[model samples]
Target: MNTITANQLKTRGVSIIQDNLLKDQELVITVRGKEKFVVMDMKHYNYLRECELDAALHQAKADYQSENYITETVDAHIKRIKQ
Candidate 1:
């Protein structure tokens, strides 16, 4: 992680993105000396998105188990969907 002031990031934004995007490096942008935002590579961003989705699915499964919800077999679920 690297810190860049908001003004410096705005002024030299393109060069900074070009240098860091491929390396999966992140730039922490600050405002009034307080951390405000982060800029990261697309790959890392997508990876984070996937992680969030997985966590949500895991939580859903746990909730279903705790509630004793019945789950149909894969073939039965597919047949019902096709109907």
Candidate 2:
């Protein structure tokens, strides 16, 4: 992983990120000697979000196949959750 200090970012700005991202898919931003934030290209970020959704969908399908869910009326569902 590539890392950049907050001071470097404050002094150099987005161009440093742009240049680093050409070599790495992501960059870690550190603040006050602690890892604080991550920076990535929007396309990469969207791709990762899609992957997360896909994993969730796969888990839901597996749960359904295993009969791990319930079927109930909306009122019953709300009442059960309220309890």
Candidate 3:
């Protein structure tokens, strides 16, 4: 992984983005010694979003075909996710 400390980002932000672009890599931006952000090309981000949507659609189709589902009230579903 390519990591850039917060200090480096303050001074070399543009260069870092340019350097990573040649390799189509993800950049990890750290703040206070912890990874706090990621920088990736917009195309990569869009591809990831498409992949997520595809996976969700596939799961829904499988669930329907198998009749695999559960019924719950909206409030109960919300509580389940909050947990």
Candidate 4:
């Protein structure tokens, strides 16, 4: 990871991000000397999102195997949700 201060970002803008990203996959942006944000390319962000979804699917499958879910009618499901 590469780090850039908020002040440097404010003064340098996207050009700074572009330069750092060329050398690294991601960046950490600091605000008031505290790490505040992470910046990554769209490709990496999409990959992360896909991984998150895959983990959720795996958990759901495990839960199903454990008989942890309920089966209800549409109206019952909606009523339960409202409660």
Candidate 5:
């Protein structure tokens, strides 16, 4: 991870960010002495999103395997929600 001030980003523009991202670097942007933002390449961002989805799916599978879920039909679910 690399840290850059908000002012530096404003001065250098998004091109500097693109250059760093080519090396698989992530940026942490700070403003007013506090961490404010993150910059990452789209490929890495998509990979992370996929990882999160996979994790959720795995947890759901585990829960189902352990009989830890409730079973309901769509109509029943809608009726309950309408109440």
Candidate 6:
């Protein structure tokens, strides 16, 4: 992990962001010798978000498949409900 002081990061924010953005690196920003923040490339951030969404979708699908209330077809299920 790469670490940078809060002052250095604040003064050279653009360069730090540029370095990480271009190289897909993670920057750990520290304040008062303690880690405070992290910076990551947009691509990595987007991919992480997508992975989270996929995991959530997968879990939702698993839940739906295991639940007896879910049906294969909405129309057929509605007709059964009406009958």
lDDT of 1 by residue, 1-83 (tens): 77778887789877876676556567777998999998887887999899999999999999887995657999998998899
Instruction: State residue 12's C-alpha deviation in candidate 6, in Å.
Output: 2.4
Q: State the weakest 10-residue window (summed lDDT) of model 5.
A: 16-25
lDDT of all predictions: 0.82, 0.97, 0.87, 0.97, 0.86, 0.81
lDDT of 6 by residue, 1-83 (tens): 67778898778877976675565467788899999988887787899899999999999888878883555598888888899
TM-score of 5: 0.80
lDDT tens readout by residue for model 5, 1-83: 77778898899999778776776558888998799999997788999999999999999999999999877999998998899
What would the TM-scores of all predictions be?
A: 0.70, 0.89, 0.75, 0.85, 0.80, 0.67
lDDT by residue (7-79, candidate 4, tens digit) is: 9999999999999999998999999989999999999899999999999999999999999998999999999
TM-score of candidate 4 to 2 decimals: 0.85
Stretches > 4 Å off in candidate 1: 21-24, 68-83
Error of 4 at 10 (Å): 1.0
Off by over 4 Å in 5: 73-83
Query: Once superposed on the true structure, which residue ranges of model 2 sit more than 4 Å away at CA?
Result: 79-83
Q: What does candidate 6 score on TM?
A: 0.67
**Each prediction's Cα RMSD?**
7.2, 1.5, 3.3, 1.5, 2.5, 7.2
Clashing pairs in 4: none
Clashing pairs in 5: none
User: Where's the lowest-lDDT run of ten residues in candidate 6?
Assistant: 16-25
